[model samples]
Target: TILSSDAYQRSWKPNETNQQDERNFSRMVVRRLPAEVVADAITQATASNTRVTAMTSSPTDRTIGPDILAKNNKKLTSLNYTLSVFGKPDRTENCDCERSNAPTLLQAVFTRNDPSLISMINGSDRRAKGWIAEVQEWYSGKTKPTNQANGNKRLKQLNDQRKKLLAKAPKKPRNTRDAKATQRYQLTIKKHREAVQVLNRNISKLKGGRSNGNLVKRQITALETDKLINETFLRTVSRMPSANELNMARADINSNQDKIGGVKDLLWTLLNTKEFLVNH
Candidate 1:
C-alpha cells in the first residue's frame, strides 16, 4: 500500500483544485537516515576539512569550488546537496507516510557484543548497563510469566470465565432487554477467548527461547545454526560470479594485499565500506 501510494504521487499531476499537490506529496516520506550514513557523513566531513586545510597551504586548493567539488567527490557533494534541499520544510501537509521507523536504541545497544558485525565505541559499557536496566524495569512492569505451567493455569482460568459468561447469556432474545444482556455476555466470552489465545502464543515463544544447555553453549549453538541457515540461503539464491568478475576480484585482492600495511588496516577498510557498515 505504501509503495502504491508513493507510485501514485510520483505520477500525479496538479490541477486547479490541487495546486499544492507537489508540496503535499513531498511530505509523504519522512525517514531518518541510517546510523551508518550519519557516521559516514561525519567521517567524510572531517576528511574533507583535513584535505581542504592541506590543499589551502598549497596553490591548487583555490580551484575547488562547490561545482568542482561536485565533479571530483560526487558522493560527498550529493550528500551535501541533499541535506541543503531537504534540511527543513513545511510540515503542515497531512501525509500517511510520516516517518521511517528505525530499530530502537535498545536494540542497537544489544548489538555491541557482536564484534564481527559492529565494533563498540568507548564508554559503551556504561550506556549498555543503563539500557539493560531500563529494559529490565519495563519488562517487569509489562510482561507476565510465560512458562508452560503458568500459561496452562491462565488458559484454564480464562476458559472457566468464558464458560461462566456463556451460561449467563439469554438463550432466547425475544425482547430488546434480553438481546442487550446476551450481547454483553457474548462480548465478555470473546475477550476471554482472545486472552487464552495470547497466553498460548506467549508460552510457545518462551519454550522456543529455552534450550537444553548452559547459556554459553546455547548461544554458540544458536550462532552456528544462524550461520548455517544464512550460508544455505545465500548459496541457494545468489548467482555465481562470471569468470571475468572472478578474475577482477582476485586481482583486486592481490592489489590490496600488496598495498595495505597490515591485516588490521585491511580489515578496517573492509569493515568501513558501505556494504559492511549498513544494517540490512
Candidate 2:
C-alpha cells in the first residue's frame, strides 16, 4: 500500500510541490489509534511470549538511520527485531503557520474589545459566570455590594443638602445679625465639605485596600498595553494602501475616486481570499 506521504506527493503537480515536503508519517494509517490504545497495545505485546519491536523517530531528528536503530536496540532486550528507516518527511509546512480560521484564546484576550470573543471566553454557564464575576471584582477593586450602595446613597444625600443650603444662603450681609447668619452658613458648608471628604476617603479604602491595590494596578497596566498595541495596529493598517490602490498607482491612474467601483470589487475579492481570511 502507498503511504500517505507518497500519496500526497503524487497528488500535487511538480510546480505545486513545496520546497520542503510536509507529511506526517505517524498519521499515514487509515485509522489513527489514541495514545492510550497504542500504549495498551505496546504493553500487551511486551507481555506476550512472541518478541515485538516498535520503531519511532527521535524528538530532534525526523529521520532515523539503521546504525541509530541498532544503537537503540542495544539498550532494550525485549525487542526481537528493529529496522528504523531514514528520510521520513518532517511535518512542518513552509507556508505561514500562524494562519487560522478563528482567533485563539490568547488572541481573544489581547483583543478585549470583541464582544463575541469575550462572551466565548466568559461562557454562558452559571459556574463560568461566577468565576467571571470574581475576576471582575478583582479587576475593578470594588467594595462589598451593600457598603458601596450605602456609601453612594449617603454621598448623594450630602451633596444634595449642601447644594440646597448654598442656594438658600444670603449673597451679602446687610446687618450684624445677617453677618452672623452668613458666618453660620459658611461653617455649615465647611462641615458638610469635611464630612463629604471623610466619606470619600472611607469609600476609597473600602473599594481598593492595600491588599488588592497592586493587583488592580497590574490589571490596568495590562489593559493599557493592549490598548496601545491595538491603536498601533489600527494606525499601521490605515496607512497601508490596498492592492487596488497599488495597481492604480502603477498604471498612473491618479484619480482619487473609483469610477467602476474597482476598489470596492478588489476589496471584496481580497476579503474573501484565503490570504486575507487567515490570521497570518
The TM-score leader among the candidates is 2
Overall local distance difference test of candidate 1: 0.38
Candidate 1 lDDT tens digits, 119-141: 21111211122222222233333
Instruction: Give the Cα lDDT of each candidate.
Output: 0.38, 0.35
Candidate 1 residue pairs in clash (backbone atoms < 3 Å): none
Q: In model 1, which runs have C-alpha deviations exceeding 4 angstroms?
A: 1-219, 222-280
Clashes of each: 0, 0
Estimate TM-scores for all models: 0.18, 0.20
The deviation in Å at residue 257 for candidate 1 is: 32
Kindly list the per-residue Cα lDDT of model 2 for residues 1-280, writing each as its tens digit.
5565666556332233343444644222222232223222322221211111222222321121223443554332211111101112232677544323232454323223333222322322111232223333444655345555676676566567656655655444456578778897778777766766665666565455324323342243434433322322222232345556455533332242421132223322332233332322
| Candidate 2: segments with Cα more than 4 A from true spot | 1-140, 143-145, 171-280
